[model samples]
Target: MTMRTFASMAKPGVTSALPLKEIPGSYGLPLVDSLVDRFDYFVTEGAENFFKTRIQKYKSTVLRVNMPPGPPIVSDPRVIMLLDAKTFPTLFDLTKVDKRDVLTGAYMPSTDFTGGYRTAVYQDPSEKTHGKLKAFCFEVLKMSRPRIFPEFTKAFDELSVEVEKEFENEGKASFSDKVDDLIFNFLCRALIGADPVAPGPASLGNSGPTHLKTWLAPQLAPIASSGILPKVLDELTIHTITLPFALVSRDYKKLYDFVDTRGSALLDVAQNEMGLQRDEACHDLLFHIGFNAFGGMFILFPSIVKYIAKAGQDLQREIAKEVRGAVEANGGLNMKALESMPLLRSVVYEVLRMDPPVPLQYARARKDFMVESYDAQYEIKEGELLGGYQPLATKDSHVFANAEEFVPGRFLGEEGEKLLEYVLWSNGRETDESTVDNKQCAGKDIVPMVARLLVAHLFLRYDSFAVDESSSSAIFTQLTKAS
Candidate 1:
């Protein structure tokens, strides 16, 4: 396995012909440096500033630095930061990068959290299980296609009612909270033919998302801060030390049982058709739905709305007009209707570029390889950890003009469409196809489709809406409907 050149990996003209330079920055002194970097990462500078200040210090997009969840949890916190679009795609190349145990970056959750199985996410393409599990994931997505649009509408219809009722009574509605509920419901209904709200084998009631959050929080705590605790306390506790999985074992068990009962058909296909054990299938199914599908939506839908809300009514009116026109012309809001609405599609793509649901992507160098930024190349040794902070990469000013601003039509037209290669929200480039051999998201197409549906539905039901962004979540303060 060998490294592809910067020119080969990135869009033409995105890479430079400049000579290689030594990677700058340092790990300082072992754990001491990691602890300080971790403190600055979580406590002082925050995620964006942590990288920004360093880029300014080193004056390079590619630098060596300490990533968080350092010493005890992760043996080494050292990573070569690939901050620009030119170098970020190297993380996608399996020929040179080993993806095992780097999904969450630096640390991996206990297999106990995943029913004593590694789950598909932790496996690299080189691993034997990767092919089977990834293929199964693709199969599940294929099975859910027919239900995806209808179930999305069903769930979002309920969400609109909830938002309307809340606004009528309380004068404002929390969009994040409402959307989270619908996303979970929609995933359960479409993927497994079970509803968390409906009574049955899958009826965990509305507590389903809560159960999943409880299970996921521990796994993510080492690399993430809850913001619920003081910065120092959060850093010392969840950020420094790995939380015991035993705490969430019961929550996980309940989720596992729910899937074992409700996802029996998916399990059957996994076992009989795909050669996985029933228990392994159940755990992977739960992870795919709970973590990947529901979790992706939990972060993504709110982001889409937040960006649109902040973009103001001018963008909203344009999108609403396009959505309504497409639906009317096609005689319904089906795939054909979605295909005709470029503004709606661009809005979703822009949101993904701006605030990718998963902000960091990780891989380890499989062998010695040279990676490049605009002006310099850095030789990465075998087994070196690599991290790509995608938000910064996607927002590269060279690739996107006015990258910081929310331009809803940024991805519209022939020229704009070419920029899709830069959208790395789904593990792989937006233009890249998801295959079992690559780490790209299996439901890559499905996610955008559902997201577009959510936006299209919102505009169809209401003319324009106003959001309060002072808080972390979007609060719908005003929703105007066409008379």
Candidate 2:
């Protein structure tokens, strides 16, 4: 019989604390909690495994999945495998069923299956149906300052002003606490939008955000100091804590009921004030994006920030060199920024190499087909796609030098064509990659442009100093300092 150990699922008005089986693959057992601990490792390693599994089985079937956080959901590799197999016209078939995953909480596959299923499909992002797969960069980035990035930066600036004023009297720990407060508000305001089209759950009217924030603050407190918690926990606590918010806000039944009553006008009010365009984007994409982006940026940004702060010897020079050269002195950064800044470009390349945000991309088998059929005359018909990460084409040692180091200038010498072509999305032919492997994050092509510009401004305008001898030591000390 199926076992039950720690089956935890969250849905509106319902909390799934059902005990799940302790087995390795069972849903919601504590082991699954490892998703929080080794997120990158799991995605990268798991993708490779899935790829190898399908290629071995010579099987084909659409496998639906539901991993949390809306993290890199569309990056599933089955789609890539299908496109790859299509070239052979006989290797296999792949289909990506972009289903509504988040609201449901559990992935009920198109069919309930038995052993060795293609299970990498996941991500419950709320978009205009599969739009998250397409729209994250363009819809979010072009918005004016103080919406996503600008808005958060503004909140941080206000918080920075307050922190600076208080620094005259506050202690070091106090300064840290204030900074955390700023981060909290910055996160909320950035994700929720400035206006109230910003529908959240029953805001507790009087004490929800505060109470939740207050309740959540301690979770990170130890992370800042005692250092007992691992790196992943410290970084991901907010996203995990915000799950309850999802449980509340997704309650359209209750929300619509309220709209039917007195809150009906809120729709128009929110639409106008929040600048929400039905044709543009949705609150779910905006909010959930915080979840996806926070993980991606924090995974690498803190380290980058520390590098900048501590590299006092050459910080300004490096910034000006990469930015002025890549963004300004050159043409300008639009999508093409994905090339240029070979040094900064390698930064992204190496980070993705070392830590793929989510190794798997979501897709399923549309039909069965064969692999090596020319020799054995056998088949892997319909649904099976290769089960694995495409590190072959992505982080291929031949394509990338050192393939191991975080060398900032690794991509510098390649000509624009070679550098642009080296990226996983642009370099490989079909049957050679996983789904999301072919693309970086949405707007990935342009992300480096924005980041380089932002970092350039910070380095040029602000004289940043190391908070301590080594930024890593600072990270270690922060484990115990924030509280």
Candidate 3:
């Protein structure tokens, strides 16, 4: 719908002139209300449901919500939750807002921690530095696709074997841990051009793919907790504790040293050709590939597997048939073969629609702007934190039919292609081209390719697998072998 159309649907009660602080919302108890309620909302209903609850209560798409303050967060009071699709696109338009200032906030990581904010994710599109970094990343990622397919194929092959062994041994296989390790290794290999596992003395304590998880846990713990104490600790310890460990810890040091030693030609190009300092180039690479791409897969892969398992036999069969046809048509399991599987691609899109791993996109208004919802327009002040809770927008009833259900072929045809704009979980709209100027994921195409490959490989290896989601972790059981 157009802006004017959405503005006309604006509800009558909440006016644009109302002071943002006075905006109706459950501010909760003195100190802990927002925190307690937020925790409860996520714990009981999941992160996707958190915005739905607020939208229902506030009766407006935009609401002032309290969130723990950190980097990319200016002041807690400025945080605004957006629950509609119409204005969500504004978040990615870098010209409308300054991503660097908004994301950096009060805590710019010391050069020792991240080498500096030269990474594309943190840089404003207008900056020459952003263009250099973005171009370098895109070039590296594009060239790495050939490497990515085979690496992912091998990883998933090993994972299938691991799952089969687990199920045979214990009658059930919890694939989450294995999925995490597999993606971590795949991403490291794709980005750094080396296995993540440390060698020799560095391998003594923390040797394998699990090293990223171990090294990141303590550092991310505070940020995840999200409160005054955690924020304070994060600021104090990021440089002192996190940076030092990132440099010296066996697991982390290997990655750091790899960039330093030109483990990948990308690293060499970034440092020598681009004229970026070694540490700066290393930090940028780590942030773009490690923090953004690897971190995304860490969550995305397992979620895809979970949904595919839950989809049951009929859907699995359809996927398998499509994948098999594509593989045969292409004569191999290459990029063309993977891209040719329409049903597999649809399933990935549907999974992303139902449960996007990264559900929220945050931005700060460089100037005052009016954002319209289905029923009303709200004035967002300069420097105010704007968050688009993507799960809500992607599933808006007006946009998708049977929005809550997992329609496997939802995006398979022409009508389905029209719904692409609603799927904004990848930091940019599906219609938007990935570019250095916008926040669109540089690995947008690659991420889905990886998901499609996972599905293809799983079905190729087994006829179908059943999921036991009765417990906290999903266990894929009843592996019917392909004849």
Best by TM-score: 1
- Tell me which residue pairs clash in candidate 1: none
**What is the clash count of model 1?**
0
TM-scores of the models, in the given order? 0.95, 0.47, 0.84
Candidate 1 accuracy as lDDT:
0.87
For model 2, what is the alpha-carbon lDDT of residue 336? 49
Give the residue spans of candidate 1 off by over 4 A: 1-17
lDDT of 3 at 81: 72
Per-residue CA lDDT of model 2 for 1-483, tens digit only, reads 322111111122442333321111212334354353235333333444544454444432212122333222222121223212212222112222222331112222221110112111223222323333334333434342335445545645654466445544443213333433333344444433332223554332222224433322332232132244554664455323322223333332232232223322333433464454432233333222332444334444444544444445364456455655565554554334425555555555544444444333333333442232112222233443332233433554545566545555554563423543434321233224323322224445433444453454343334443445432432312111111
The CA lDDT of each predicted structure is 0.87, 0.36, 0.68
Cα TM-score of candidate 1: 0.95
- Report the Cα lDDT for residue 121, model 3: 72
| Candidate 1 per-residue lDDT over residues 1-483, each given as its tens digit | 223354333234354466657899999998898889988988899999999999999999999999978886756889998999999999999988999989878778888788789988899988998889989988888888899888989998899899889999998988887787798889988988777787776468888888989998988888777868998888768876777889998888878888788888888899999898888888888999888888888999888888998899898889889999999999999999999999899989999999999999999999886786788777788999999999999999989999888888899999999999999999999999999988999999989998999999999899998888787888888889764
Kindly list the per-residue Cα lDDT of model 3 for residues 392-479, writing each as its tens digit.
7888887898888888989988999888878887888887789877768888877787888888888788888877777545667678
